[model samples]
Target: MKLTTKELMEIIPHRQPFLLVDTIEELEPGVRAVGHKCVTYNEPFFAGHFPGEPVMPGVLQIEALAQTGAAAILSLPENKGKTAYFGGIRQAKFRQKVVPGDVLTLEVELIKVKGPVGIGRAVAKNQKQQVTAAAELTFMIG
Candidate 1:
């Protein structure tokens, strides 16, 4: 299923300027999700991240992955109204720079889950399908 930004807000707790994912192109409730983020020079971070050369921060890429994972999990009926807090990040790698005009494809699949905690395998790719960032994310539902 696809989820618009408005419908996504109902499942995930995030707002603009912080909310990274612009759209969820694919979803399987609690299993996985594929999201998109259109990187633009207008992003607040670009103003200070670099004066002349603006690149999307690696941390924000991971956050986008986490948000995608959160949306996947929180969309479940049992997880409605719940919040997913980052428990940890492991083996994160940045392969390329994401710049203005790039469309980031964020993908996350739940690898494990028990009670209120879970782990997800995530990756972010650029328009050319080149890996831009990747990580294993752990989360706790609250």
Candidate 2:
């Protein structure tokens, strides 16, 4: 199922300047999800990330993907009303620079969920499907 930013706001606690996801295109409990983050030159971070050349930070890409995964898990009845906080990251790698006008596609797949903890693999790509970053993220639900 797909969710707009408003619906996503209800599922994830992140707010403006931090809520990287613009919309969720696909979602499947304990499985996978696809979300979007549209990069614009007007973004606050762009002003300082670099004076003339603004590149979306790699960590933000990972966070964007992780947020998508959190949304998927949070959508479940068992996780509703709870928060998913980042526990750790593994094998994170940045492959390219993400700049203004780029639509970041975040794809995540749940690897395991036990108790209040979950692990997942996530990747961020551009409109052309070129991977910009990827990582294994651990989340602690509360």
Candidate 3:
């Protein structure tokens, strides 16, 4: 199923300038999710990320992927109302720069979930479908 920003908010607690994922294009509860973010020059981070040339931080890209993963896990009937935290990150790679006007596509698939801890494989692509970032993320539900 697909989820709008509003509906996504009901599952994950991120908001405002921190809510990186704009929409969930696809979701398979506890399995996988695909989210999108429309990058714009007006993003608060652009103001200080750089002076004349702004680049979306690599860390934020990872967070966006985590958020997509979080939405998938949190949307599950058993995980509703819980919060997901970053437990660890591995094999993270930033392959390209992400700038304004780029629509970031984040895809995450849960590889393992046991009790309150989980791991997901995540990848992010730019509007051109070029991989911008990728990583294996660990999450802790609370």
Candidate 4:
């Protein structure tokens, strides 16, 4: 299913300036999600991150990934109204710089789930299909 920004807000609690994913292109409720983040020079982080050479923070990319993962797990009927908290991050790697005018394709897949905890595999890629960052994210639902 496809989700607009407003619909995304229903599944994930985030707002402008902090809401990273603009749209969800694909999703499988409690399993996986593919989303997008369009990078622009107007982003507030760009100003402090660098004066002239701005790059999206690696941490933000990871957060975007987590949010996308949240969309998947939290969409479940049993999970609605719940929040996901970061439990851990594993094997995170930044492969390239994400700059202005780039549309980031974020893909997150649920790898395992047990009780209120789960793990997801996430990756962010640019328009050219080059991986920008990747990591295994662990989260706990509450």
Clash count for each candidate, listed in order shown: 0, 0, 0, 0
lDDT (CA) per prediction: 0.96, 0.92, 0.97, 0.96
Candidate 1's residue-wise lDDT over 1-142, tens digit each?
9999999999999998899999999999989999999998899999998889998899999999999999999999999999999999999999999999999999999999999999999999999999999999999999
Candidate 3 achieves a global lDDT of 0.97
Clash list (residue pairs), candidate 2: none
> For residues 78-105, could you state the per-residue lDDT of candidate 2 as single tens digits?
7888899999999999998999999999
Candidate 4 lDDT by residue in tens digits, 1-142:
9999999999988888899999999999989999999999999999999888999999999999999999999999999988999999999999999999999999999999998999999999999999999999999998
Candidate 3: stretches off by over 4 Å? none
User: What number of backbone clashes does candidate 2 have, counting pairs of residues 3 or more apart or in separate chains?
Assistant: 0
- In model 2, which range of ten residues has the least summed lDDT? 27-36
Q: For every model shown, what is its TM-score relative to the native structure?
A: 0.99, 0.98, 0.99, 0.98
Indicate the worst ten consecutive residues by lDDT in candidate 3: 42-51
How many residue pairs of model 1 clash at the backbone? Answer: 0
